[model samples]
Target: MDSIRFENVSKSFGKTKIINNLNLSIEKGERLILLGPSGCGKSTILRMISGLETITTGNLYLNGKLANDVDSGDRDIAMVFQNYALYPHMTIEENVGYGLRIHKEKKDVIRQRVKEAIDILNLTGLEGRYPKELSGGQRQRVALARAIVKRSDFFLLDEPLSNLDAQLRGQARKELVRIHEMYGQTFIYVTHDQIEAMTVGQRIALLNGGDLQMLDTPHNVYHRPANIFVAKFIGSPSMNILTVKMDGRDLVLGGQRVELPEMWQKKIHEKEGRGLKMGIRPENVVFSREKGPYSVKVNIHYVENYGNRVGFYTEIDGEELISIMPEDEFAKGEDVYWNILPEKLHFFDGETTMSIGYPAELS
Candidate 1:
């Protein structure tokens, strides 16, 4: 049985629907990332699963049992919120064991569980420190320890690393995976940050405007996006898109005709006269001054230098395209030649914004 399941679920606030006709299943021992921007209902979905928010329609199941009417406390989930939610007056051990104490567990059992949690989280020596006395990262670990001590059925973390510094956040991301590995419970993490979703999740459920855009392995979502929103959202600089027309198997773009990938040539005949958008990741656009088989001349409009690599926003055919290179080689207004990697091109139906296909192997 699935760990958690939502069938045709919808949530609302009076007149506004926050989550619309959603259907999702989270597997046992699987780490799923609920990813989207602010106000996208990702958090609401988490809350609903925890039984803190009511499901307006459809069914919610926890461990193959109906859970729509279940109380939050009875859900057997350990959630770490963005703010850590630690008590200022309690020491680390006290905070960690508070939940067990509330359940009337024996003092000895609570102490053992709390010790195991704190030790696993590297808080072994700092058990005596209060939440206010520890550093931000230390306190974040404390929040994790508190949840860990519960040994709950599911672990729900809602942007728990948001408050950490960049370096510490990166460290905590690895730490979270370690914690998950140690516990091996069903994990659902909600975050607006794409990096967290990509790095930590075994699978990603990308949502937007209360709609589930796609749910798949991270590689598939990144390389073979279902639609334009996902293609644009998952990448660092976002994929560069150009609307093109299929001229009897040749792609017509920017008043220039370029040969489509061989895999597309066979598919193009049936799609003639169809308006399509060709997407290319910034990393796949090779920048050089030399002409190539499929080349485009562009004027650099913006240069973003990130020490090890450089990003250029260029204008071509009235559309802004992004390209990244390892070293600084071009300047603003400097005309340059760049070629799109044939196999990396993604074709999208113009009207539907859904992927037509990418260059793929035919069985």
Candidate 2:
């Protein structure tokens, strides 16, 4: 078993800190993705694990053994880089067997290992091809094949599919997931792509501003974000957030009374005199052809069609909000009433930006 553990890891250069005091653990054979925006230390974490970057403080453990001082080559790990890092002068087979060759492995053994990797990556008939002759996806496969051939205890991937075209990236995502399933090896994949993080990872570690926000299943990360940054970052079409005030006995936004479910009313009752932010996902807000209770009439600013679904962009009380509808359902420049289901509403403390939900479930 090759479990990976980071105990209060920190990294810095000059006056800039890249990774803060971070702590995490991953079980053997678990596929984990590190996701965040650029410069958020996602790739830095991967490089630290690969032993390419030295940790400034704390210890790294591999299968319960301290690995803070381990050499990159001796870490029993394989890394697939974003650029595919293949040797242009070498043929596919030679490139895949390069590491083993350098270690002075027997000719027959290297040949068998390379052949196995080629078969696993479906590069069987392309053994003699050069990196320059292959397509983007093919070269990526070659890179992954080289790593897979190592048969290491852990696989570290640093945005391996970013160089491919959008269409090819989608195809590669499926292939990578299939490869993980086939091998059942511990994989630490790093990417800034939210779709890739959502689709490929069995679990995700969401990092932001050099801080670990939440580490949970994709569903939890998406639906129950740890704080405001995550709540606004993880969803498509973005969740709509509005500043609200508790006016006497009502939650008021833009001088309009908002109706919330009884359960939610109790949840925010203690914070009645304080400021709050209400969030509603685009899909959770409904548009009615007629006015209803707590409904706000808005002018349709624009409409965007996403094949099966349509996003109705509107201006309500000097603020822009979107309502997702069926593609064939609505038109631009039409007046409509929009409202949110109280139970689905998310309330956050204005000062702290932390969500107000079930404490046990959230914490």
Candidate 3:
């Protein structure tokens, strides 16, 4: 196992800056995920680590040795791209043991390693099949088998599941996790899908517009987001953000007065009536038929049922708010009351886009 580190790393292409002073560390045997939207530099970071892209500045270390100058083939890393890059003319066994063949390892040793990898990936019966004869998932397993058969120091997966269907992606994710467990090598994966990042990564590094936003576990990133961008980006049903003006102990939202939590009220009192943006997740919104501390009557625009839960698409005071409920409970176009709990609410300064109501000590 090898530990990977990048310090003050920057990369550029002509006039465009792709990565900016990015610093990250992947411990030995860690599963680190680089997550962001398209053009956010996630793939750039992965390529830089694999020596495919030259860094404009900064130091990169692999197992405590400088690696920025290392050649891609000498880096002792296996890369799996989105498109399964397999040899069409070679059988699965040949494709998996090609490196060993080129290096001229003992034939029996190569056979043993290939058999073990095929068994682990559940590709044993298809070893004699050519690439064209196998399914997409089977071909992907061949790619994985080739990567693991070499016993490389690290695995760099660049959205390897992106080409598979949703169901296949799910199955492949489980297989990847099983592979990680079987071989405790550091695995660095890149993906634009937040769901993939959340489910696969031990810890995720979030990027946006060439900047690193937050690096944390999925629970902390979802529940205690470092900034508004993270809070808005990580959740499936995006968090609801409302712009409101502070009015002493009350926050004014669409001409309606709403009381603030004591901690938030104290901070607003110190700020002196400044406007703020408050975030609330969809699951936190409680639907009711009675009056509450902060009640809003909303028109139910639509309801989408997905198995066990339903997503109620609605508009409140001209702002969109989605509420998730039990699938069998409600109907569309029904008038309903909604309220969000204080603990579930997050305050952000409108100017800085930074989280508010957090203990000053934490800052």
Candidate 4:
């Protein structure tokens, strides 16, 4: 059974629609990331699942039970917000076990659960310390400890690591994976951070303008994006997109015929005389001193060195493209010959702005 399911779910505030007919099913024990830019309704989805926001339409099922009308406290779920909401007046132990106290659980049970959570969070000696005495990272861990002691199988984390520095966030992210493995629980992480979503989530649901853009494995969503929005949003440097016109079996970009894989020939013939969008990642682009077929002359505008490699932003036939490669002897305004991997080409329909899947092999 699906752990969480949203069937035609929609949320609105007055006349403004926040989520428009979202349909998704999250499996138990899965780490799913709701990723999108701000105001995309990702956070609203989390709020609805937590019972903090009322669903305007359709149903939300939790573990095969209708959860639209369920009380947040009775749902057996724990949430960690972006801000560490630890009580400043209480010790770490007291803060971690506060929920048990609220539920009026036995003192002995609370003590044992608090100890386990402390051990898991590596807060052996710091248990006596208050939130005001701890660092930001430590305070963040205290929030997690509170959730951990709750012993809920479902976790809702809303950018819980966003407040930490880069190094601390990296460390916390690894710990979160370890904790999830140890507990074997379902994690619903909401974030606009692409790095966190790419590394932490097994499946990613991308939202845009209150609409579900794409939902799939991280690899598929990265490599086989559903549309232009997804194609651009997930990548770090983003994919290089060029508007092209179909020239018989060739793709004419910038009024020049661009070399592409043979597999696209049949597809292009079927879509003859149509305008399409061509996508290629920066890493797939290669530069060589020796020029051959498919090589285009480009004027390098800027080169950014990242220690291990370099990024070359160049213009070719009026189309700007980015190519990341090893440190090479190239200067600004220099003419360079570059080529893109044929197999890595991404084709999209211009009108609908959706991916046009080319067959793997034509028999």
Candidate 5:
């Protein structure tokens, strides 16, 4: 089993901490993604697992054995870097078989494994070409083929697709999933792209400032964010957060009032007279010509056309809010009523910014 466990592991460069006390586990054959913005210690965590970076404190277990002091070459890990890291002078075939050659494998075994990797990554006809002769996508495939030929127990990728164009990145993501399914290796991918993290990972470990923000399936992270940070960070347009005050059976936002459902009324009755942050995704904001239950009136200030969809920007109180609509039926300066479903609402504590728990339907 090629499982990895980090028990209270921390890393620091002099006095600057790169990874705080972190406890995480990756099961054998699990495809996990370390996702965060730049300088969030995601890459640092990946390096620690690959034995390229030393842990400053705590224990690291690989396959139920302590591996904090293990050598990088003996870790049985294959890594694919962001730059594709291919030897410019080596032909595609030579590059794919380089690891095997270095390990002193028989020539025949090396040739067969190289051929298989080439075919799997759709580089069969380009085997004779050098890295400079291939496109960005092809060179990336060659890099992947090289890693695949190693057949290491652990496969680590550090933003491997960051250099590719959007279309190529999407295609490469699917290829990665197919390859992982075929090999069943413990794949640990690192990326700042949310689309890649959501699609490629079986589970995502979101990090911020060397601290783990949330660790869960993509669906949960999207729909049930743990706090205001996760709520604002995960979504594209991000969840619209507004300061609201509990008033009797209604929540007051600036000058507008939204009646709370029975469930929420009961849940936040204790918080009456106190301030809270209300969260609603742009997609969840419904537009109607006439005012209805829990509706708030606002004038659209700007409209952005996205072909299949439109983004309507408006202001509530003093905070800007956006709503995504399927069509552009309303123009700027038009007054519209918008409301969110009771189950779609998320509430956070004003002081801590932590979630106050979801309603029964969402929970």
Candidate 6:
């Protein structure tokens, strides 16, 4: 049975919908990330699971039991919030052990559990320091430690590392994975950061404007997005999308024509004369000095140095595209040859903005 299942779940506040027909299943001991932009209902989904927010319609099941009416405190779920919801007056030790104490645990047991959580979170030295005395990252860890001590079957985090610096956030991500492995609990983490979703999640449930966009393993989500929204949302520089018309065995992008590979020609032959959108990741756009079979000449309008890699920005007709290359080989205003492999190409239906399926090899 699934640890948590949302059966056509939806949420609304004062007639304003926040979550729309979300059907999802989270396996026991799986780390699932709810990822999307702000106001996309990722956090709202987390809250619904935690019973902090009520479902407007449909059912929620926890461990195969309907949980629509379960009390938040009776759910046996521990959550870490984005704000590091720590008590200002309580020391780190007190805050970490407060939950256990409230449950009527013996003092000795609370002490031992608090110590273990503190040590795991690297908060041993600051046990007596209050939340106000701690750094943002430290407080965030303390909040996590509090949830860890609960040893609940379900663990939820709402952007718990958003307050930390980049380096600290990276470290915290590793720590979270380690903690999850140790406990083997069902973890539902909500974040707008794609890096966190890509690295921490066993599977990602991406949302957009209250609708579930895609739910799949990170690799598949990155490589085989469900629609145009997902394809543009997951990548760092975002995929380059252009309108193209299928002409016989060629795809016409503005005035430029690209002869489709023999295999792709057979696959999309039915789409001939139809309008479609072509997508390619910036990293997949190869730079070459010599012309290839699929090569196109483009003048670099701008160049951005990203330390390890460089970004070459150019326009084909009126549409802008970015290409990431390892080294800075061409200067701004220089005309360069670029090509995309057949396997790297993504096609979307023009009218619906949904994927038109990949080549046979990738299908």
TM-score of each: 0.96, 0.93, 0.93, 0.96, 0.97, 0.97
Candidate 3, which ten residues in sequence have the lowest lDDT sum?
354-363
The TM-score measured for candidate 6 stands at 0.97
Model 2 vs. true fold: TM: 0.93
Writing each residue's lDDT as its tens digit, candidate 4 over 1-363 gives 689999999999999999999999999999999999999998999999899999999999999999999999888899999997889899999999999999999999999999998888888899999899999999999999999888886899999999999999999999898888888678899999999999999999999999999999999998999999999998878998888777665666655676566688777666554568888888888876778677666778999998988999986566789998887678888887876566788888888888887657721
Off by over 4 Å in 6: 271-274
- TM-score, structure 4 vs. true: 0.96
Model 1 lDDT tens row, 238-274 = 9999887877657777777777767888765555556
Judge candidate 6 against the unseen true structure and give its global Cα lDDT, from 0 to 1: 0.91
Per-residue error (Å), model 2, residue 276? 1.0
228-269: candidate 6 lDDT, tens digit per residue: 999999998999998877777777775878898888777666
Each model's lDDT comes to 0.89, 0.85, 0.85, 0.87, 0.91, 0.91
Q: Is candidate 2 or candidate 4 better by lDDT?
A: 4
CA error at residue 197 for candidate 4, angstroms? 0.3
Poorly placed runs, candidate 3 (over 4 Å): 267-274, 328-333, 357-363
What tens digits encode model 3's per-residue C-alpha lDDT throughout 1-363? 349988999999998999999888888998889999999998899898889999899999998899989998888888898898999999999999998898788999999999999999898788888999998898888999999888888999999998889999999999988899889789999999898888889999999999999999988888888879999998878888888777777877766777776766776666554557878898887777776887766667788888888888777567788888775466678877777577677777778777765645333
Stretches of candidate 2 off by over 4 Å are: 270-274, 292-294, 358-363
When summed lDDT is taken over every stretch of 10 residues in candidate 4, the lowest stretch is: 247-256
Between candidates 3 and 6, the one scoring higher on TM-score is 6
Please identify which of the two predictions, 2 or 6, would achieve the higher lDDT against the true structure.
6
The sequence of per-residue lDDT tens digits that candidate 2 reaches over residues 298-343 is: 7787988889998888765566788887754767788777765665
52 Cα displacement, candidate 5 (Å): 0.8
